[model samples]
Target: MQAPINIALVGNPNSGKSSLFNALTGLNQKVSNFPGVTVDKKTGTAQIVPGLTANIIDLPGTYSLYPKSADEYVTYDVLINPDNADIPDLIIIVADASNLKRNLLFCSQIIDLKIPVIIGLTMMDIARKKGVEIDLDGLERELGVPVVSINPRKSKGVAELKKIIDLAARGNYSAAPRDFINNGALAKPVTDEIKKAVPGKSDYAALHIAVNADELHFLNIPQKAAIKQTLQTHQFNKTKVQAEEIMQRYNRIKHIMKSTVVETDPLQKQLRSEKIDDLLLHRFWGYVILLVVMFLLFQSIFWLASYPMDWIEGGFGQLSGWLTSVLPDNKITDVFVNGILAGISGFAVFIPQIMILFGLITILEDTGYMARISFLTDRLMRQVGLNGKSVMPLISGVACAVPAIMATRTIENKKERLITILVTPLMSCSARLPIYTMMIALVIPDRRIFGILGLQGLIMMGLYLLGFFMAIFIAAIMKLFVKIREKSYFIMELPVYRAPRWKNVGTTMVEKAKIFVTDAGKVIVVISVILWFLASYGPSSRMQPLHDKYEKMIAAVPADSPAADSLDKAFRSEKLSHSYAGILGHAIEPAIRPLGFDWKIGIALITSFAAREVFVGTMATLYSVGENPDDNNATLREKMAAAKWPDGRPVYTLAAGLSLMIFYSFAMQCMSTLAIVKRETKSWKMPLIQLVYMTALAYICSLIIFNIFK
Candidate 1:
């Protein structure tokens, strides 16, 4: 049997490469990191025919073989390294038909490598709408390569593309014309030396090795040194050679296009998208619209998700009650119900809000407005020691900081990228939503000040904006201290606006929800089990005394009486106060008391070091354990509202509630985020410094807020 076919899907950014990849391998894809870098590598398997299976790799997008950022470098490295284990047997180049000229520049370079190349044309509909027409057969003849026009969204031409791929993998296909560029006499010496150093490599590939030998991972110290020596000996000008090669390729492409393609008179009129952008990208109005859009986003997160959130909360409460009734009253049942189930329910109830958050974000991205946001924020980002590319990661940080920090890989400037990573977590993520929501409900009045905007939502928006501004402020300060000097600029193409891809949006929503559940859920479960062990079993001396006191109190009150209910709560609270979890909380209480937090709040602060969302789960387990069994149906908000200190003052007062909100808003409570930071920066020093600074900031902010409100 023939070896499984390996196909690499390559494209410029936003060239619809990912759409084609999704079309071919719908549910068969897996994401992994590249060999020595953290950039993601996506690979999937597709059945080309009944008996032929193909391994398809979706390479990171690049505008040219010459790379800029880490992502683009990954693509270039994979293509030039012949010994790469995952190198393709066949290369499918996806190009946007609407933007053929710029897209073909990269395609031309790839073709000269003498690989079996197939052109998978995408966005033909967009091209036709712009009055651009192509003579497919004529173009195919000119380039001596097979061209298949496809609409990956509609799954059109995919079958033919698969057949072409299968044939190419088996060496049953013809190679593209390999003379796109003339290697001038000046380049002959350097190219010839590169060929001798690396046999079987095409002249174009060998030329690349000569120019970028230092950056190539496949070359060892001796190989790189030898190539450098040869280039120096020949007095080769790498830049001049590359520029001339590009001009030659484009010159040939120009004549081929004259015969094989018909384009619209672009000077005649502006596109519909450009006309729309006139208002959307306007200086003043654009900022206004942006603010309105963000306001609506936060409002929706509160209003739209409320009903489903309530249903989840009530349903879990009922489920907990039923489990309590069926299971025998014992330690095992207690742990299962209050420890494991309670923890799951805490995060499970917030899934609806999380879904809405990511769903809206996906829609924004699919419609092409997300790029414009980067464009709009570019000037402001510059003020904060970042480039326009930093805007994407900061905006994405609202959904989750791990992916946001990962997104910083696109920023080419080292100092700017590091500053962006250091401050990105300041943008309140969805994990903090649960804390913000609960605290706002506890303290903020539910009245609308502007007649249309709910006060709760407005407060939520304030928190979001507060976090964003704080990020910028912090980034500005970091700019002063980080002494690295590097030139930074932002260059991005704004794709034409299109209708949102509902299928892609839905897929993203499901995938994000799955990530949140699986990743955050794992941490929650372990912390919950440990918390239960600590909260349930205290010192034996303390445990025996509590048991004796509760037993006598129960004997004094009639069953199901008000007095019995009161005594039960007292007994449970006292037991928890002496337990190991409570002991830990008490140990830190003095340090946090100035911020209006008690021993219970201290417990939450400690557990939440695992993750910000775990604060809610910690509260759920603690409150559920202390409640009367008959009152299991009470929502957490109601339970916390009724909680009082030993001195009888309400625990969640205006001062303390505001203080808690302020703390969470500023604190760096997520271990996962810190891990991602460490990975991104390649140093524990940055994360450690970040942790100390943010925690200190949170304490000061909370302290000031509590005093002002009190």
Candidate 2:
């Protein structure tokens, strides 16, 4: 019944902090927002010793305690505020052994907080490859803390890491005997005053609060006032103090490094990663490799998911048909089989494709190639009013725009970041994949050109490329109109390449697949139920008369005759036409008709505003209601393909499918994305403009595409 031991994992970005967390926690981790903020807080439970558990928190990656962005602030707040729920009983700083100096800066800062500390050195192999070696015992002696070398990706030294964490949690560990910086020398008066005001805080913690009092939300009005007064009285210059502390720390770090570590001359060595990057980062070859990667990604989305998607569709169809057969032919049976079941199956078939897409993305990230993608695209990004950093958010938009917009926080230039946010939605996210897949199958042939590339896969790749191109084009246009003047820069480290961790990759696949099914599925199912009711029932007066007329006509015709079947089809169509959904669709048909969409598609467009993926579910429910009993086991794709207008033209022809794809590629149909934009931009102005411009663009492009194809 003892409380779980608290351990926090902290590090600079790309220092293997995430890999360590994954190795320690395995499947026991959960991700949620930190308090009221939208930033992700990842926590997990690990058994650190016999009969004892440790609650490990993986904090946001930050370079220093002084934060410049929202994500960095979360890390700083948790570390400094003892009252935080995630405040650690022990701190394990994961440092990159390959890049010791830069990583040590953050570690040195954390140590000065006087917390119990342990250094988990990662990338030992990479360091060795670079002809660098560190003496662990020497490092431990110099820093006066427990130091362990680990490779989290390979799960090496994980047991040793756990033992260290357990020992520290039980109070068997202490901080370095020597502080990295002398707080009194930096600002004796301010530090002394803060210690008196905030009892039990270390000199480093008190100093941090004094310098960042205005930005610290936990401090009360009186405490902030007192800190401000103390700073003024002492004439404490925060910038000067910080610069002095950094120089002093680096000087000591250099002395420690000379005695504890050895490195070969850079001119004598070339790393494997460097050799690989020579080709991958080459000006002309880099672009070619990037394109090939993207092409294969879209291709795999279809090729890998094909079998599983078929299984899901066939399984659901059979289940629906079985339910229809066992249950009596009644409205309740219809609702359960057609409304709810059909809705679930409609989107479930897409899970395999989503999982594969995320799995590949995770692999690219783990292998360190993802960073090079930004480096390669920096020049192109500049042309569109963005820097290399914006490439991450824009590419991440392929998975989901809500988090992608949040990722823009890493971009330092406000104007460039805003422009990136405004156009990110133009990238086709996974939510649109189902829509794209269904439409492409409806119109595009299954045959492959050149005997290797499937036409459907090619079309899918084209849509994704189109979306990316449109995002950049829109960003260019926004740059002209947005009136903020700011300089932008892109600075990033290219980590040494490593093999993808299969455990991490598999975990991501399951988590993302689960999210799509549970989160997007909820919206699709609820909307499908409502859509079913709207499509099934109308004004009682009209519905009753139509039903009565159909009964008489069907009764007059012979059973199993073509005439009877024709009359039955006519009657069901008439009933649906008089229904509420039909009325709504008809009302909007005029507006969308010029782009090759009809009343039914208009209904889908309106309902799918809840989520882009709902368009598939809407079609499923609509078609299920009027579907011939003989075709009960038909897939949604088959049903959509069979649909025809009153004039005998197919509803989802080549022109209409292409037009719809183009529209989704350009339009901002995701409400969640819009809400996130408003939250990030701090007003409705940017989101409104984004919506209007994207919608106008979608409509105009669809108009042109539909006309050209028709």
Candidate 3:
């Protein structure tokens, strides 16, 4: 049996590492957590040769091996700890060819581990376009490794890269080490100490790590006594001494590049991207442009999704009506149509909005605008006791709070990250859209505010803004209580802008949609079925007698009586629904009575916890029960408008609708979100806290709204 070779893919952020991993492994990848940690671990297998399989692990992106955050720690630990279960037999250091200087910092560290390393130079097309020419043979000689230029997006050079991996695994390729130590006599003692500490480790890499101890914690030394003694004898601080050695290595790299690399145009460095970035990164217009971009993003969510949402709603309504006509009037039919089918369709109705939101985000990220957003938002974030990196999680909260919370792992400071996670759920997610749309349509007038902002649109925007501002406010308050001493910095690479990759955007949309439908869909289907059964059968013995009595009264009424037809329909529908099950619904009706909700609305709320959008479908299903075949006003909106309370008051008064919207906006109603939070946080405490806080807030807020309106 052939032994499977372990290969680790490492790179800086946005170096096309993920794209390369996807191309190499395809669907053979599995994402899990590192042992005892919530950090993501993505591993896959690629056939490196005719019979040998290579297990490829995509390590988290980091600038250096010295980790400050939980996610970064995983990468640092995996690389240095040989006792790790997935220790790589070979290391592939992926570098962005466009930014060689910064990329090389990581490569230099990896090389010091004395492992066989190959360089996968990504984005060579970008480098070529900028009039940069790399001497591959010279680079290989200087780095003591084979360098392969790959455009993973285009599937270029991947096969050759794989072949190189196979050869490296078989110990078939070796390059002579470049001379990095020019002052070997002066640094001999320190280098010897490092070699003794880590047996067989590269002297050059150890020297670099020892010098830059403050910047990146490469060495696991508990005390600096030995290094101090060496440094004192040499009259240098160990940190500065290590930095000087790294500079020596870089000087040699620069010398080699001067000989082998060429620039066709001297002014090619001042490119169009640089010119555009000057404006986009400017202090004033940069912020204005960011605001405008965000405004447009939110506007697109409502305006663009409106037509598709209507289509989904209409299509589902028609389907439900058709099912009612086709299926026999039996318990099973009722469960299938009213419970399972209706529930699934209800959740499916929100796919267009979710897809559009995800697609836009993916596009922004691909074009490097997300990093810009992080940079722009950093100052404001720092004011609220969060590092600039916190912006990533906050923005992610707009799509789903669970991943947003998980993304907080990138924030190095523990207190700041915890506070960010605690408040992220306040951001208006796509899940809240159905509730917002339904309630706004029902309550807020369709007119403009001051002849400028649409009233409904303004309210919607206010809700999102409220959530955002509240998150910051809460974080600020939490900052005063939590004690933290770690220093935070915002040193992020701003990649050159590029056109969005449609393939990546499309794949993201499909994947998110699949997760939503499958995970949330199951819970919704079960709930809807239970609700259908509850609403369908009653104490039929008592119900039948009461219904018969009403029927006879209608029969005994004078044929010419003006109220005969209307009275008979009302009496029959009521008696049929008012059986034992109906009595139970009525019993709970009074509990929700304070919020201007009837038992039916209570049922909708209960079922909608599976997903907020299911509220519309639940209402549609409930109101359609026992209706005649020719009933007009087929839309939920139309039916809701015509619905009346027992006292002849409107069931959907402006007060009730506003209260409902408030309730949905604040409720922790998504089971999938809860599950994801549990998975990401690695405990149920945080999610349980979220559930309690959100539910209480929703109830209190809705209660206040209903009472004030009443």
lDDT of each: 0.87, 0.88, 0.75
- Lowest lDDT block of 10, candidate 2: 263-272
Best by lDDT: 2
User: Which is the better candidate, 2 or 3, if ranked by lDDT?
Assistant: 2
Model 3 Cα RMSD, Å?
Answer: 5.4
Number of clashing residue pairs, candidate 2: 0
Superior by TM-score: candidate 1 or candidate 3: 1
Model 1 Cα shift for residue 218 (angstroms) = 1.8
> Residue 66 of candidate 2: its Cα lDDT?
85
Which pairs of residues have clashing backbones in candidate 1?
none
lDDT (tens digit, per residue) of candidate 2 on 368-437: 9999988998899988778898999988998999989988887777888899999889989999999998
Candidate 3 pairs with clashing backbones: 211-242, 539-580
Say what the RMSD of model 2 is: 1.5
**After superposition, which runs of candidate 2 have C-alpha atoms over 4 Å from their true positions?**
264-268
Cα lDDT over the full model 2: 0.88
lDDT of 1 by residue, 492-541 (tens): 88988877778877877788789778988888877887888898889998
